[model samples]
Target: MREISLDRLRTLVAIADCGSFADAARALHLAPPTISLHIADLEERFGAPLLSRKRGQVRPSAVGETLVKYARRLLAEAEQALQDVKRQVEGKGGRVRLGASTGAIANLLPRALELLALHHPGIDLQIAVLTSQETLARLKSGALDVGLVALPQQATDGLTIKRWRRDPVMAFMPAGWKCPARVTPQWLAVRPLILNDSSTRFSRLTAEWFASGGQHPVPRIQLNFTDAIRSLVAAGYGAALLPQEAVAPVQDPRIAMRPLRPALWRELGIAHSAEDIDRPTQHVLDALWSLRLR
Candidate 1:
C-alpha cells in the first residue's frame, strides 16, 4: 500500500503558488531540501512526476493538477470539520435542516427564522421547499430534521407532531365583482377557478370544500404557487381559494379577498422524527412556537 501525505500535497501547492521550490520553502518556513524531499516522496508514491519546471518556474503537471484540486477540497473539508467541532465545544451551535410546504414557507417561516436568528445566532438553518406530504416523507426518511406541514395529515409512525396554526382559506375574485361578504362554496363552484395543483393537500382540501357544496367545478388553471393563482385571479382569469397568509403580505388592489361563510382553514403543524430531536432542532422549534404565540 502507498501512503499519500497531505504535507506533500501542501508543499506541492505552495511550490506551484510561489513558482519555485526555494520560494515555497521560504513561504512555508521549511528548508528548501525538505520541500524537495516532500515532492520527491509524492512522486515515488504515485510513480509519476508531480510537477514540471519551465524557464525557472514551477507548476503542477496534468495529473498533479487533478490531485491538487482534490487536495484543496479535502483540506477545506478537514478545516470545516475542525471548526464545527470547535463550535460544538464552545456551544456556538450547529445546523438544523428544515422542510416546509409552500404555504408555510410563504407565510410562516420568515418570521420564525427571524426570531431564531435573534435568539440563536450561532445556529444555521437549512431549508427545503416541498409539499406537505413530501416534507413528512423526507422527515421520516432522515433527510430532514424538522418539517412544517399542513394537517389533518395522516400520522405515520415515528413522528412527533405539534399543532402550529390555522390559516383560513379565502376566496379571491376580481375587484368589484360583487360577491357576498362571506362567499359560499356553492357560489364559488359555479365560477371558473384557478386552484392549487391537484398533487397538493391544499388542492384536495379545496376540492372537498367544493364537494361539500355538492359541486365539482374543474379549474380553469391549476398552479403550485399561491401568488400565481392570485395573479391569474387579478387578471380576471378565474376565482381562487387561497390561504389567508398567502394573501396577507401582498395587497393587490386588482383582487378582492373574501372570507368563506363557514371559514375553511388549513391547519399547519411542526413534525420531527420521534427518534431524533437534537438541541438545534429544539431551538428552532422553540423559535417557531414563539412566533405562533405572538
Candidate 2:
C-alpha cells in the first residue's frame, strides 16, 4: 500500500478550512486542478470518498476529518524538528562530551565552562573525569568529543593534539615550614613528600625534575588526586609538587606555595578526533583556547 504524503493531507485540511476547493487552491498557492487531483489521490489510496458536497459547499468526509486532525500535529512536529536542527547548525544549541583530569576539572575546566555558558548557553556539556591515557582511549573509541590531556604525549593516528597550556609546577607545603622563596629540587627532595601516583604523567615530570638536580627522593606517600595531595600538605603531612593554576585559590592559610628554581612545568593539550568537528565541539575548543596562557 502507498503511504499518504503530507501534501495530500494539507489539501484535505485546506478544503475543510475554506469550505470550497477554489479557496483552498488559492490559500495553498496551487492550481485548482492540482488541489482536486491531490484529494482524488488521497481518496483513491484510502478507497473512500474524502469530500462530501452539501448545499453547493465542499466539506470533508469523516475519514478526511480524522486525517486533517492528525496531519496538523505531524506538521507542527516537523516544523519543530527543523527549528532544532537550525539551532544546532548555528552553534546555538547542542550537546558536547568532554573528558579531563581531576586537576584540570578542579583548576582549569571551570573557567572554560563559564566562558562557554556565557557565550553559548544552549550547549550542554557532559564532563567526565579521566586520566590522559583513558581520555585518549575514549576519543579513539568514539566515546568522547574532546579531552584536556597531559602534554608530551606521542603522536597518535586519527587524533589531533594541540598544546593548550603550560603551568609552572610549585612546591605546596604547610605554612609553618620555613620554606624558601624559590624551592630547588634538592631542597624539596629532603622533605617528607606526597606525590602523584607513579603512573601519572605529572609524577614522571616531577621525577625528571628531581633527577636533573641529581637528587632522587622517595615519596612518603603517593596519591592520584591533586586535591587530596594538597589536603595532606595543608595538614603538614608532607610537601607536594603540583601545578599552580592562574586561578588557583590564594587564601589558604595553612598551605603555602613556592615557585620551583629549575622551573618545571606541567603542560596540557587539547585532543580530539581528526574528523571534521561539529559546531558544539568547536565551540568548546574555542572556549578552552581562550583560557590558554599567553
Candidate 3:
C-alpha cells in the first residue's frame, strides 16, 4: 500500500470536525467529490473503514479517532510552517539582524529602532554594536542584514551604501571653561584630549582631521564607550571630539559642546548587501529612511 497522504488525512480530520463531508469540502474550499475521494483514498491505504455515517451525519470510527488526533497535529504543523514562510515574505514577523558602530548606537539609532518596534510590532530585531570595519565585514559575509556605518571615504564594491544623516563632530568640554563658540583644530590642539583609541574608523577619521591641521595633542585618556567619554568630559578629564547626536541625550550641567570650525562632520549611512535585499532588510531600511536624522 502507498504511504498515507497528508491531504487525505486532512480531509478525514476536516470532515470529522465539521461532522459532514459537504461541510468539510466547503471549509477546505474543495469540491465535495474531491473531499469524498480523499477520504476514500485514506481508507484504501489503511485497508479498513475510517468513517461511518448515520442519519445523514458523518462520524469517525474507532481507528479514525486515533488517526484524528495525529492528523490534527500534522495539519497544525503544516499550517505553522506556511505561516512562518509567509511571515518571512511579508517582513511582518521575522528576525532582522543588524550591526552598527558604537557611535551610531550612541546617536539616534535607538530612536529609529524604537520607532520600528512601535510601527512593525511583528518584526523581531537583533542589533550588534561593532566598529565600521567589523560591520562591513559581517555584512559582506551575510552575517548581518543591515548595517549602520560611518560613510567610507573609499568605494565599496558589493554593498549599497546611502547616507542616513550628517552630524557635526563637536568638542565636549567642561562647562565654565569659556571656550570659543566654535572650536578650531588649532584651538582644540592646545587642550588635553581624551581620544578613543585609533582602532575604530571614527577614531581614525578624527585622528586624520587633527593631523591634517598639524595638531597632535597629547592624549590624557583613552576609552571607547560614548557615555564613559561624556562622563569623563563632564568630570573635566579632558576634551573629546564626538558626533553631536552622541551628546544629545546628555543633560549634565558640567558638560558643554562646541561645534568644530570648518565644520568637521561624520556622515552616517546604512549599508546593505547589493545582491539580495531581503524583506527584513528592506523593512529596517524603510525605518531608517523615516528617521528625523535622515
TM-score of each: 0.72, 0.76, 0.74
lDDT of each: 0.84, 0.91, 0.83
Residue clash pairs of candidate 3:
none
Clashing pairs in 1: none
- Over the stretch 116-235, how does candidate 2's per-residue lDDT look in tens digits? 989999999999988899999999999999999999899989999999999889899999999999999889999999988888888899999999999999999998887888889989
lDDT-sorted candidate list, best first? 2, 1, 3
lDDT of 1 by residue, 104-156 (tens): 77767888778777877888899998988888889889899989887877878
RMSD of each: 5.6, 3.8, 4.2
Worst 10 residues of 1 by lDDT: 242-251
Q: Give the Cα error of residue 14 in candidate 2, in Å.
A: 5.4
Q: Is candidate 2 or candidate 3 better by lDDT?
A: 2
RMSD of 1: 5.6
